[model samples]
Target: MRHIDCQKRISLLVDGSLDGPAVREALDHLTECPDCARAYEKMVSLNNALTNVKPSLADSSLASKVKVRISGESNSAGYAWNFSLLKQVPIWALIAILAVGVGDMAGKTLTETLNMHDTSHNLENLIQDNGESLTDVLIDFGQSENGR
Candidate 1:
């Protein structure tokens, strides 16, 4: 078998889980390849060390502190909305409303301005078509008032 295949089965070999042709092939590869032999030795040392290690106990007060933090009882301030003040308001909604208001005002002003311009232009055209100046029209109106 290839060195890679033997290396993959090294863990199973240490655990006594490999059997039959696989075990024989892995053993043969380990004997022929110096690298595979070294890897197998390291795996054996690691397994032995892990098996000899004893489990450790945590601090007695660690569990109580974690429980208090999770329940929010560690602080006396009483959970006063932990988020930002600006987050309470819908800022985009207000901005959209203001934009619509400004647009409406602009539209109204534009319409009024265009109407005034058109009125003045029509007045000027009327004066020109009648071949009369401002002074002549005023004098005619005054004469008609006096005759009345």
Candidate 2:
């Protein structure tokens, strides 16, 4: 087999997972190819070292410490969601929007009132210029409608 193929099979050979023919081919390749031999040696050393390593026990307070940190993080995330993009908006901009809305409503009301006042003032001027009382104008309007 080629060096690349041998390199790929090195882990399986080190773990004793390869079959008889595969094992012989890998070993023969290892003896002949220096690069493959070095790779095989590294894999064997790593496997042995990992197998001899003892798993360390966790501290008794580790679980409680992790739980506390998770709870604190969740609470902070909740707070962040609560204080959203709307909260980041400037107070002056909100006040300006409110002021503009109120001003628009006030201006509309004033314009309507002024229009009503102007209509009444024009009616009064018409009556004074023609020297006609309110009743006289109404009677003339009635007669004109009847004729029509």
Candidate 3:
């Protein structure tokens, strides 16, 4: 077997999950390859160390507290988060309005500045296309309004 193949089998070997033939092949490879042997030794030592570890919890009520929080039985801490978010709503709204207003003004100013030289010629072209100038259209609007 290849060195990498033997290394891959090290975990299953440590867990004692490899069958007879595969175990023999992997052990043969490990004995022939120093790298595979070192990998196997490291995995075995890590497994042993983890197996011997004991969980230490200083606060016994910590689990019960977590359960209460998850069940929503105790909500004193939850309200502070909700109330703080609610209090910031108006400030956020004002900031959004200010952003929109500034954007609109900047857009208008940029367009007007960029199109300054073309404005009069563009208006005349538009006015002439439909047989109506600005003054003629305004007069027509006035006549209609008077009729209304």
Candidate 4:
């Protein structure tokens, strides 16, 4: 038998459920295969430990109750299924959101800067001109009231 076949039958061997021929074959394989020997020893220890455990409760077999409890636990609580896809959300989505927010903030900052620049230019021109041409005023005012 293959290692896998021997492995599958190992549970039966550990539980003492195997027939005489199977027992002989398993022992023969154990003599040759160190990996199977280790596995067999582990299973033997687990079985011994399980056999030694005592039940505190009255009127119930410990092994059967433990089996039922394990079966229920496996059936009811194991293998949680989720359709929410929460784990599927990409880091790129967060990065894109961050990029869009930063771009919007940058655009606002640039627009405000441009508006300030335009306002500053207009104010400087107003200050320099003083609202009237100096030469026109000078020519008119320089002429005397007697039309000189």
Candidate 5:
């Protein structure tokens, strides 16, 4: 086996997972190659160090405390206002209705204040004039308006 392949198998050998003819080949390579032998030694040392470590939890009742806190928050009645009736109504429909009502009232007020008839014709003219250059529109508007 190549020195590189033997180096990789060292970890499997350290973990006792390497088997059959592959183990013999890796061991033979490790004996002849100083670098592969050093790699094998390091792998063995690392495996032994990791195996000797024991982990411990800081709080034994942490899981139960977290569950109790979550349940208490869900059941708590701290809210002063209830929006159940508001939730039952469609909020978007309400907003659209109010917007239409306000727009109609403002349009009527503007038309009355302007003392103008044929609002649709005026709206069409404005739309058509928007397609022209600003200077041309201003010149036409100036010529058509009565002296003020």
Candidate 6:
């Protein structure tokens, strides 16, 4: 099976939703493939984490008090209708971002123009394709001297 489909099966197995045959097959694959085994282990850990999680009581009262306080403190600032300070923000930020972008582009262009050259690091590939020895290539390079 494709790795993606197998991963889906792994999730189902962890959720205890896989059929008998599918569970068996998933387990079998897990046993043979280390990647699948690691994935299954992760699923088990995730399942344990989810099942053991409980809603906290500590924040219940805090949330209610916070909402009341926030409501008292709130104004048009929290709504889309208030655009006093936010209106200039987009224009200023856009201009600043564009300036920085232009500077970066100019620097990169200058550097590229200064270092305009192509270099080939294909010694291994050349040797493999031509079935030539490295020592022979080096000797030829040394003798030729002109980099032919």
Which is the leading candidate under lDDT? Answer: 2
Q: Compose the digit string of candidate 2's lDDT tens values, residues 1-148.
A: 6657778899888888999999998888888888888898888888889999978756768888899999999999998888886798999999999998788668467666556656788886755547778799889878988999
Which regions in candidate 4 have their CA more than 4 angstroms from the true location?
58-148
Flag regions of model 6 displaced more than 4 Å. 58-148
TM-score of each: 0.36, 0.37, 0.40, 0.37, 0.39, 0.38
Models, CA RMSD each = 22.2, 18.0, 21.0, 21.6, 19.3, 30.9
Model 1 compared with the native: what TM-score? 0.36
* lDDT of the candidates, in the order given: 0.78, 0.83, 0.81, 0.78, 0.76, 0.78
Candidate 3, poorest ten consecutive residues by summed lDDT: 124-133
- Residue-level lDDT of model 4, residues 1-148, one tens digit each, is 7779888888789888999998998889889999999999998998889789966677558889899999988766544333235446688997898898788667477666556657778876645645568886555556753496
Say what the RMSD of model 5 is.
19.3
lDDT of 5 by residue, 70-90 (tens): 887766633312455556779
Regions of model 2 farther than 4 Å from truth: 58-148
Worst 10 residues of 6 by lDDT: 118-127
For 48-74, candidate 3 gives per-residue lDDT tens digits of 999999788988799998897777844
Which of candidates 4 and 5 reaches a greater lDDT?
Answer: 4
Report the Cα lDDT for candidate 2: 0.83
Q: What lDDT would candidate 3 get against the real structure?
A: 0.81
lDDT of 6 at 21: 92
Query: Model 4, residue 133: what's the lDDT?
Result: 83
- Cα displacement (Å) at residue 143, model 1: 99
lDDT of 6 by residue, 1-148 (tens): 8998998899988888999998999999999989988998998998899889977777588889998888866854466446655675788797998898788667477666555544333544444436568788777768878766
